[model samples]
Target chain A: MAETTRASDPGTGTATPDAHTAPLSEFDRDTAVRRRARGEFETVIADGWSVFGAVNGGYLKAMVGRAVAETLPHPHPATVTAHYLTAPRPGPAVIRVETVREGRTLSTATASLTQTDPDGTEVERLRVLATHTDLTAGPDEVRTTAEMPDIPAYEDCVGMDLAPPEFLRDAPIVHRLAGRLDPDCVGWAVGVPSGRAGTRGWFAFADGRPVDPLALLMVGDALPPSVFDLGLSGWVPTIELTTHVRALPAPGPLRVALTTRNLAGGLLEEDGEVWDSAGRLVAQSRQLARAPRG
Target chain B: MAETTRASDPGTGTATPDAHTAPLSEFDRDTAVRRRARGEFETVIADGWSVFGAVNGGYLKAMVGRAVAETLPHPHPATVTAHYLTAPRPGPAVIRVETVREGRTLSTATASLTQTDPDGTEVERLRVLATHTDLTAGPDEVRTTAEMPDIPAYEDCVGMDLAPPEFLRDAPIVHRLAGRLDPDCVGWAVGVPSGRAGTRGWFAFADGRPVDPLALLMVGDALPPSVFDLGLSGWVPTIELTTHVRALPAPGPLRVALTTRNLAGGLLEEDGEVWDSAGRLVAQSRQLARAPRG
Candidate 1:
């Protein structure tokens, strides 16, 4: 009955009466925005893109990135930072982008994602500042001191979609993407905990869509909080997140490593690095978030 | 002749006509902002707090932080991200702050530092988004998996102020603060590049002022770019910087470690960690900057 209902569900809408029509990729469709006016866009915060009732911060950032990318002359977001003012539910949202500075090499813009409350009051959910540039035209020099995180091969890792834990069974977002966690990093899933603060995994869209600069934002925060490995459980809300797109990712699953260094004064800082299948460092992110209750 | 004129230099202004008067610490006086109106402030970007010709990014951030802290109910800036639109020289500037959200545990604000150009056009130099809260009221739990960067004792390190480098002699900002760098990290100074991208040092104000939350902002970007150790040269301009204040520093010189993990496509991401004398993590920062023209 569940599988039959999913076929006709309006949220997925993958099966239509007209069998000849093709459907959009989940990422592209959910992140799509329509221009309302000059520098203004409207989009819906689609279902199944949320965690623990609130829309995922990175997914919201990707939506804003799409709006900012459209308004700028550049083709990609080079560096972006978003501050979560308040979490919004699955509903309609308005993104307003303002050009801060448009240089020949790089252009900077500010975007605000706002949603209206039931009481007819509009509240801003997320505020973003991003600089966009054409990655192909950027300098070709490559030098890196950071190494790609060492993790088990995709086939050797534990597939999250195969059997998600009880707590994550209600999280539709987890099912939307295919993820494989490092065995050592998932000790907390069992009765034993690692007592460390780090998570390494490989990720790709469930629909096998190609990842782009905008998609990198979502990948940055897609994993479970690193603190979970240390036996801490609860929702870890991000206060501010910053992502630097180092290069356009190559095809294939992206490898990600999230590590928390300092957890003090009720706050913790998590640093993440994403490497493409080609073993190229594609993106880096750091976020400050409130510690979990437990 | 230079010694005789130093006493009357207005930039330092430590020697005044009234010898009995005490002077404000450089960190305090330089970051001071006067309220001009509601949610508005005016402050000067002092001359000594600059590198090359442009004012330092961290110093500018500290000044903007002061304004944001004043308007919010919170006392300390918990997390702040600043995007440098354009580097401003030493001059008077205006800071405009707006309260975005005032929650029970945290308050969020946005600040803009604008200065009038010689053409009489007002230009925004720096834009910042910060969340503030009282660190003392935060959760007492502490869990850290990151270890402090190991370096020799402060007395064994190379004092940058003792024999200033030729390139740094003109940079007054270096002299305003005393720094001792690890010998291994300063191989680039003598033309023997280490081929590594890391720098560890001890830092404190030249006037012996205690480091505070605001000063941590300056220390985040105080050291020379870590790429210098890799034989890179030229001024590395910061595009966007995010600093998380984990805790207030315990009195004494700060132990700072700056490391660049990746440098690609004419941009690099540098991560910094600041540990106070009490061996507590005080701040963590990550910045995306343009690669130096070597």
Candidate 2:
């Protein structure tokens, strides 16, 4: 469903099929498909009207990596930091990528996406840094992280859940990857594309659907809280997401062992490490998420 | 020497002492020390009468952590992020720290400092989050990191000839722990408190002046170029510093292995893992540093 901009103001008017009676399409107007010779990925966005309560910062970051991979390299890793200048959209935007360096051992690339109003005023801008490197056996540093906490299965978790847009049902990939979101339980995750160092995966929800790589990344942003949402209960919307993939594991189910380090007076943070099927450290992510709730 | 304000409007004025020219005896007047104890760590301020060509966001972050440590735990590791609200003072300002959580394994804290106008209007605000944890040799989940990079001696770097702060020159602890700042070179470091798991030595300037922990932290922050700065002739200021100390090594001669993972467009990050003489991993750190021209 393409949004029809009011010919007068591009920012006004939605391309909804019906004013009030129709359900919106799963493939909303913001959905666009990128078909590259090497790789093809589809992108869907919110025009500031987030599927979740807030615009998804992690989704945009993961998309930048995905977009770069189309013309760059596969099975690559990236360390991305996106400065959220403005809230992203649920509508279509352009993602452009350029190669930076490609050595035998490593490759680098840059990506940016932007959205503008009909008058050309900017709405969003996203910059990404990604790298692809060869897999080599290291001096063999290995550390076994905490065990995955026992939690209800996905089926049971789904039954107990309640939240916004139900786009997750179609994105089972993220759920299988991130697993259940039990703040109190440990999540066990491992990297896919095994043998490559520094890669990890998690199960998450997307637009209320099962989580995939992008969704998992988007929802995984947790930080210590402040007074911004002083009266709120639970985690705050993540304002930013910075992640690094250290190892890539073989394609398989993974586990992410998560535990909260501290939360008090409306601020909290957690220490999470992702492991591969063999229990190897694929990646370690520590986010300054919002304060855990009562 | 404290500034004395008359009974005037909050927009009042008073003669503040020259922070730099003041003797060490009046150490409280040093803006850096005062800021470390109570100023904003990092913020984006509208250009004004500050001294540095570019306002330093890095120093604020490091200093805020030090300020928080006074009220938290000693020698605790912190992973903090400061959202740049406004540019910081090239002049003087105060900082404040708060303990958010004091857990058994870790402690969480927040610090914020505001820079104000002579009229007491706000200029900028810095928010910081720090975490402290007790070290334990739990179950042997062993993992090794990349072998330490090989480099030259402390005396060989290009920056050595450049002038360093006089305090740095007199502080044998900084020299013994981090070596003189030259260009990219490897140096040996150890905790000042011998037998502790961290690098040690008395680092304050030659005159036995009070030391600032923020200064001590930066000593070990000297890292080689991120691949981005490898061929470029410039320097980068870190935007954030995240340090994790697993165990306190018996303080004595400690070693810091520094290396860089370069990003495109002069964006770079550095990672360092500290080890005891026995090669036990004492702590590790990652910094979001900028790439600056030499």
Candidate 3:
């Protein structure tokens, strides 16, 4: 089967020549930040991460997470919320971080990403607030009423590259990451939407870099808008997104489910859940976005 | 019929002398903000709004919303996310608002609430970011895959005052707002818990005030922690909460459903949806909070 072959192909599954030997995966390199001052860092929004004409909201959030994690005493982000002010293009940007408060168990901080235009004007693209804590220090007790979506086996799912959606064909980020869309949820990909507002899929870095707490921020908003399944095809710009990292993901492809429960007043809310290879819920997210234009 | 009686008693259902004659409802009077200057406002954290020892998270968010709405070009908060830093006692506080951006369709602002101590120390309580717009100007179209929970009728549910739990015996907020708990989901109130992490309830001001967009912020976090259903009964301090107000609710009691799906690493997330009296979805929210200490 073409789907099974694409899932295992070394070129697609592991983009790096040697996953174990690579110093930094493409994701880490693209989202890398350099400390310039006490609370300021410099980074670049690399090319090929755009969904339509703007950088992915989750990718921008990852940059904020990296900067925040470096400044706070606690390393892992427990909860992060980012508001997209302007769609940032691929270019040099600066991140300004501020420590809001430090508590016994958690520390809170706020950060903003801005890009300078040739006119010397700075444009604020994203503003974020996050609370950080050491995940390892948490209690071992685990209790959950959440369950992962029932997706087909890794090899049975349809690869993104197999029959690329019209809008996703030229998007480089799709190639940088290996993803599979559950056949049941991708009816819209073939011009016959299931008339539902949900999507289930699998995700992993093509280079095989292990998923971490920081990467979970990216995974939260990485899926296509669930509205597409309802035959609403257009760019659904996110107004705000909030992510809660529950645990460190185990090494393997992650399972993801996205659902839109309400669409009203030209806006919709998308709720997502991500589970690790071990079938443990790793993160949950909710985002508000504009419905596709009429 | 104790539950039914409590739900309609004049003292509990409508505490005010006259719903129409009263100049201001208790909620508005308590949440009222006085303009101090441009982008600044003064308010008091009224005594009866605390959940335990701290003020309700939603109440605090409503204060921020009021302040932000006053400074921005838009009048209603479309999306608001607040990070709780320190719990402020019932006292005078200051709200500082700043316009982050103003666009044709939306305007974004950030605000902070700080309380002063007797020692002249100013403590930061909450930080918020919000996007505001004229909700009435939005398109009238509506579509939803979400549905209200399968809750009993207003009079069939058990009133909070019918059999007040031990922890809620002294909570003034419970009395200020009349609430009914879904019988099947409130087993934790007694010796036996339902062993689930969900709660459905009906909420309205004890003073017979109409529901609005700003008040929806309070409704989002007004319910008790859903974890109580799982026998995890203690104070769950919210770290952060994000509420998206979809529409101005029709006048009447609001229907609320809260669910906690995953609890891990001493942290849990609660997702809530609120529907107005007209049975239209008005708001959606997600909050991250500490799992009650073992």
Each model's lDDT comes to 0.84, 0.41, 0.84
Q: Is the docking of candidate 1 incorrect, acceptable, medium or high quality?
A: medium
Best by DockQ: 3
Superior candidate under lDDT, 1 versus 2:
1
Q: Over the stretch A1-294, how does candidate 2's per-residue lDDT look in tens digits? A: 222211112112233347377553332222334754333344566443233345455556666666765566544453443433345655666776656445454455555667767798754455444554433422243222234435444344421123223644433222212234333221111112121112122333222222223322333342112211222233253423455454544333335544333232232333345444454445444443434343
lDDT of 1 by residue, A100-195 (tens): 888888889988999999999999998898988888887788998789999998778777765557656667787667777999898887757787
Model 3, B205-226: lDDT tens digits are 7666667788888787998889
Judge candidate 1 at residue A123 and give its lDDT: 95
Tens digit of per-residue lDDT, candidate 2, span B140-229: 333333343342332343322133565334322222122322233212221121111122121112222322334334434533333322
Question: Candidate 2's C-alpha lDDT?
Answer: 0.41
Query: TM-score of chain A, model 1?
Result: 0.91
Query: Can you tell me which runs of candidate 2 are displaced by over 4 Å?
Result: A1-43, A46-51, A71-74, A98-104, A135-178, A182-219, A222-235, A250-253, A258-270, A289-294, B1-173, B176-294
lDDT of 1: 0.84
